[model samples]
Target: MEFSFSNSQKMIQKEVRRFAQEELAPQYSRWDREKQYPRELLRKMGSLGFIGTSVSQENGGLGESYITEGIICEEIARGDCSLPMATHVAGHLCAGLLEHGSQEVRDAFLAPLLAGEMIPAFCLTEPGSGTDAVAMQTSAEKKGAAYILNGEKSGITAIMDADVSLVFAKTDPAAGAKGVSCFVVPRNLPGVTMQGYEDLGCNAVVRGSLFLENVEIPASYLIGEEGTGFKMAMRGFDISRILLCLEAISPALVSLEETMAHVKKRVAFGRPLATFEGVSFPIVEHLSLLEAVRLLCYKALWLRDQGRSSSKEAGMVKWMAPRFATNAIRDCMLLHGHYGYTKEYPLEQRLRDVLAIEIADGTSQVSKLVVQREVMGREFLPYNYR
Candidate 1:
């Protein structure tokens, strides 16, 4: 696969790097410490078309490809994962809607999202449903021309700041996967409320619990045909897992580079620490693994651009990148010695940030199972009956 970036891609990367250094990197530590999402910074990102990288130009976006989007994500995330995550959430959801939602639904939400005027959250997980998403208890009933949504969605990334949510619930509770449906619910509707959640990292994301108590939305808000939401959600994940891999790539590169510089200058026992094979060999190993995952991620993105099936590639990278990246950060921290344990250095924060990738989209074990199913076929899959 050709990994070379075109002149345009290089310019895009440069623009993202400048933005990250000037706007995001400086205040990221502060935001994480204070557990605040910077509204001003988000607005600035919107003004630059960073918030809608993959959405159509007609929808007020730059209409970047998955490769360009990945590059943008990696650059922004190199400074900090939280800020890039916020932009990723908006762009991925808006772009998904453009592909899956009705024209009327797209018209109402996509433009504002691209303009950075609206924040969108994807609400699929519930208090009871974690990995077993089909077990979601959230229920929506058709009432005349409206669907009365009554249930709770938990672990939403940016529900507090979201003006709209792409929510999934059971339209026919007894129908199993066939019962699932997706909706675009407005935040201001009656009986809809967001309660904040506290987490270990990515605090800038504004996660919360969404309670829908007989909230009514028009049938027009349905993203696609009924009973198809689960498939659409997985499709969204297949596309997003590539970007998430890119996000993890940034911090991995940062940790590796930072450690490289530190070890070269950090003297111990009459020589520089970089002279030790223990420290240097692991760094080399991590660099090699990171480059492999980077190529895998971009290949998946390129395949998607070509309208090819990328489930195997996506699942492989989804598992590999975060696992390797987290390990790289941990090893880098050890190389940093006593200073690594403190918040004064970014290693601890980088570890916390990249570790989340394992749990997001699909966990490491879950992703492997997906790969197993794809290769071994359903007959050999462990969870095939479930």
Candidate 2:
């Protein structure tokens, strides 16, 4: 298998890295401290084709391949890990829907979102159902020429700031997953209310719950065919899961890089910390593990580019990347001694941010289950007996 990035891909990576470090990395802690999403900075990024990776060239996006998009995700994440949750993960989801949406939906919502003039929220997990998403109780009933959406959406990212949400609700409650349908619901619609959460990390996202009571949207707002929303969402996850893993992995690598620089200059017992195997071995091990996962993330993206199903690889990396990223970040902090624990250091914040990835997109357990179903066949699944 080919293991090298093309020259153009390499160029994109370098330029994105430069942009991320110079523009995003400097304010990584500032956003966390202020608990702001940096909307204006995101606008700057959006104009440069960073946030519109999923949008087609005809729609003013770069029209890049899935692998290239993954590269952008990893690079952006290296600077500000939390930002990708809004831009790459949810943003990608919204684009996927809009790309298949009616021209009216695309013209109204997709354009502004691609321009970063608006924030988009992906509403899937309800308070009652997360992993078993088909169990969601939210409903969107057809009435005349519109669908009236009603239900509570919990664990939404940037809910307070989002201009629109790609909401999934069951249109036919008896049909299980097939009952689910996706819609673009504007946040300002009547009967829509929101409550923000005091999350442990990624505060810039303003994570919250959205309550929709009789919220009405036009029939033209439906994303695709009435019942195929769940399949579209699941397909998007096949890549978002991997993109998110890369986002998680990038920060851990950044933390390790920072730790290495610190150890070389930090003298302990009258010698630089890097001089001792005790201080150096852990860094080496983390680098090794993270590098392995990073390569796998790219491989998953490559498979998608080749029009193959990468569910197994996406699941494998989703569980491994965040777990290992958080582990590496935690160690990087410990290696820094008390300085890393202090607010002045980014490591404390990095740990909190990376920890959230273990749950986002899907939990680590769910990710492993995806891998198991793929590798061992669905008949062997634990849930299959039921």
TM-score, every prediction? 0.96, 0.97
Candidate 2, RMSD to the unseen true structure: 1.3
Residue-level lDDT of model 1, residues 1-386, one tens digit each, is 57699899999899989988888888878888888877777777778877768776766577788888888888999888866676787788545765567778777888777667778888988999877899999998998999999999998888888889988989988887888999999999999999997778888787889999999999989878999888888887887888998899888898899999999999999999999999899999999999998998988888887889888998999999999999999999999999988899988988888888889877888788778888989798776443
- Lowest lDDT sum, 10 consecutive residues, model 1, at 93-102
Cα misplacement distance, residue 104 of candidate 2 (Å): 0.6
Residue-wise C-alpha lDDT for candidate 2, range 133-169, written one tens digit per residue: 9999999999999999999999998998898999999
Q: Write down the lDDT that model 1 would get.
A: 0.85
Residue 120: error of model 2 in Å? 0.4
Candidate 2 clashes: the total is: 0
